[model samples]
Target: MSEHLFSALRRWPDIEAPNLFAVDASDRLILDEAESQLADIQPGELVIMGDNYGALTLGAAALHGCTGIRVFQDSLVGELALASNAGDLADRYRTHTLDRALLADARLVLLQLPRSLAELDEWAQAIARFAAPDVTVIAGGRIKHMTLAMNEVLVRSFDVVNVGRARQKSRTLTAMGARRSLERPRYPATSVLREPEIPVVELAVSAHGGAFAGATLDIGTRFLLTFLPEMKSDAASAIDLGSGTGVLAASLALARPDLHVVAIDQSTAAVASTRETANANGVGARIDAFREDALTERPTASADLIVCNPPFHSGATVHAAVALRMLADARRVLKPGGELWVVFNTYLGYRDYLNRTVGPTRQAGRNSKFTVAVSVRA
Candidate 1:
């Protein structure tokens, strides 16, 4: 059953690389294992979270005849994949954000483990607070990703926790005895980075659990910010594509009052954090933080400048497809002569692609680890 569904899956619109695959051994193991452990769960009782593509959600609905399954994914790409692949089973499941309504009364939750301990903690906390007292939670991921710290995180939310034996380099962790639900959810933690060591000082960074580097100044972003003074000064508008916590957007607005910045991220938590970071930094009025897929809705040649520190990975796989797509889309959104300022790992060789897709590319700055480039839109 698992093999049948796995073979039918595709990671459309997502980068298809030889090193990256839509389905994996872990996905197969999780579904089969969850089905056996949750054999008696009612159709609506099973909930799926963090499924890459539609494996967990579609598998349960299509193969197990489960109905009314609720699912939540942080990536906009992942959400679209599940919808596109729903086929005739679309009616059996629904997609949601990490919300109280989704988790309320859910008894059996199947999950793909997140890399961030904070993200895992956030999920565990939500399930503990929103799920039924009798709820049983089973989370799975690649063996390399599983850590003793994960078990420790779940123990805070559940009284009963067990780690399953590894199968095909994958494993699942089970939990029960949920801690009492919270009266309200408070997450996407905030931290204030204040130091004379960095140019962007006293900036309050807030990140939703999935946001990269969790509100801290990632080295790549910090490296890019070094070239902020060179950005178009007379520009009326700017965009920060794939803006995680609105770090670049907020910084731009605060640095230049004349520039109205739009910080776009696909994650709801990221949108909230961007707004929070903006508000905290007294630049919220100048920044419009949006939860969106790339800049698909923006008009062509709409911007004076854009900035990005694109992620090279989609989920667990290391690949450049996401960056390539973002760059291509960035070119569509930039006005002729408008520049897309990007800082990436020095080894990625993104300069060649930028020249082909966006326009003439020039290295704005480079350090030991990162290369910042300016790509003008043709």
Candidate 2:
């Protein structure tokens, strides 16, 4: 039954392509590893983290009759996909942000190991700080993405870390004996950016573990910032689509104190980071951070300008669909004659695509690796 359910799950509201999948071997292996625990736990004791879709949560409910499960997914799209995939099992699980509420009294946790060590540390610390004394965490990931450091990170919060045998190129780590006396969470890492090239004198960037680039400015965003002076000067409202760490949003707000800026990203971590970054920069009042799939919540033709540094990859798979979807949303949300400015790797050749998708496009700026383009909505 679990196999059939996993097979039927879909990654909708996310980029669904041949290479991208809702469930993977890691999800299967994690479930297999936690089968005994799942059977032993009562309703509401099972907590799932990093479920790509509904596979882990729905599979547990279907196979073990577990209900009232608390689940936390970093991406808004992942949460929506889980709801969309949870046909009759929808009421079995509830969603929560990663906090004490999600982990409180959880005796069994099934985690899909994230690629970032900082993320793993944050999860480990949270489980140790909030979960039941006897909680058992079963974390799994593809062997290629897993590292010895993951086990090391778990060891800091758990007295024991056991490595399971690899199956189907995936492996699980069993962590037991949570150390509730451990140090406080070291997340929402903060940094001060003093780059002379930045529009603002100094920008405060804050990020939780899972936010992309984590409290640091990625080069793509740095290149995109160079063209800010050329953006629509009289625009009253702007959106930082795919905003990571709220650097662009905060920078824009600081540069233009009167302009209202919105920071949107699918990741819960990114939204939190953006809010923290904005607040730290003293622009939180002017910036609104939301966990959204692109601009799905914004009305059509509402935004005056949209700035994006679109991602080229969906999860670990490099695909064009992710960026294309963002571009389409930007086109839809911008008012007539409004501008959409974007920075992307030069090799992707987005000039012609932007021309066809948004409007007549022009090269705003370019370096060897990145190209910034501006498209006026027609």
Candidate 3:
């Protein structure tokens, strides 16, 4: 892959690399393409959201020319980069959403299509506000993630939006326009319904104008919830790590009133869903929802139990590093003797990582495609 990127760089030497900004940077084709595209630029400043392998490399290369680079992701990226001597290269690495710093100066912005359309709209609104008239925003995605509606949104936000021919099942959108100030659209929040059949809560989710399957429960999460343990723990504090829509967290809160569960997810939509689910289930007081990157923020050793169904893929890349980082963070925040219960696809090979990082791990249960693993902090 690196060789391919190097070749692309060598081949596309004529494309002037404007100050590059990559959103949702991951360790796959986008990064590879960006690196090849960015190699020719006289390094000045590079901004990226999150630490994917590709983004890290590009940021490192940019640093060689004394380029100012800023990375906004989860805290873990900041910590790892800092530890690896890339610390000084970072102008400001943060844990929240990409701020105006990137929007204010970036001549070219590269964004991977987000999973949700609501998120896409939010980002587009931001771009409309900060991007200059000459600035170009390039958005790319796999065939499934790209759509006419997305193109329409880009057109609405920018003066001119053009969709390029699909290459290798991926497409790029180029939007050029005068910076227009637009208010971010807000979606009405919905409520959830407590299910009597199962110890679960059903969140009433609105589509929020995104590509994600709306209102319906995710199949993977539904599968995980079915296997949730019925054992009552003596521990009072718990966390639903990646608690999308608060399905698992709401269940835990309803089933065990003594345990206080904090639900956290990276997506703003997911956070909103979780909150609504908690409220509808009447567990809002017990379940706290927050927007958080799994790789950032350490919540101390307060959680006696942590539950997660970690995402195996970010963008097009299927990598376990993010999941590994989540495990490490879970370990960091778990009290001594605390339990980390995780449900994942059987092939993810997270068992070995869990065993190595968070003491010995054991398969508590299993199904055809997924396995439940538990690790105890020593």
Give the runs in model 3 whose Cα sits over 4 Å from its true position. Answer: 1-110, 115-118, 129-136, 140-153, 156-159, 164-171, 177-215, 264-285, 288-301, 329-337, 349-365, 375-378
lDDT of 3 at 198: 41
Model 2 / residue 288 / CA error / Å: 0.9
Judged by lDDT against the true structure, how good is candidate 2? 0.90
Report the lDDT tens digits of candidate 1 across residue range 190-243: 889864424466889888787878879888888888788898878889999888
lDDT comparing candidate 1 with the true structure: 0.85
* TM-score, predicted candidate 3 vs. hidden true structure: 0.62
Clashes of each: 1, 0, 2
Weakest 10 consecutive residues, lDDT, candidate 1?
Answer: 193-202
Question: How far in Å is the alpha carbon of 322 misplaced in model 1?
Answer: 2.2
Comparing 1 with 2 on TM-score, the higher-scoring candidate is 2
TM-score per model over all chains: 0.95, 0.98, 0.62
lDDT of each: 0.85, 0.90, 0.60
Candidate 3 collision pairs: 75-296, 117-210
**Order the candidates by TM-score, highest first — what do you get?**
2, 1, 3
Error of 1 at 58 (Å): 0.7
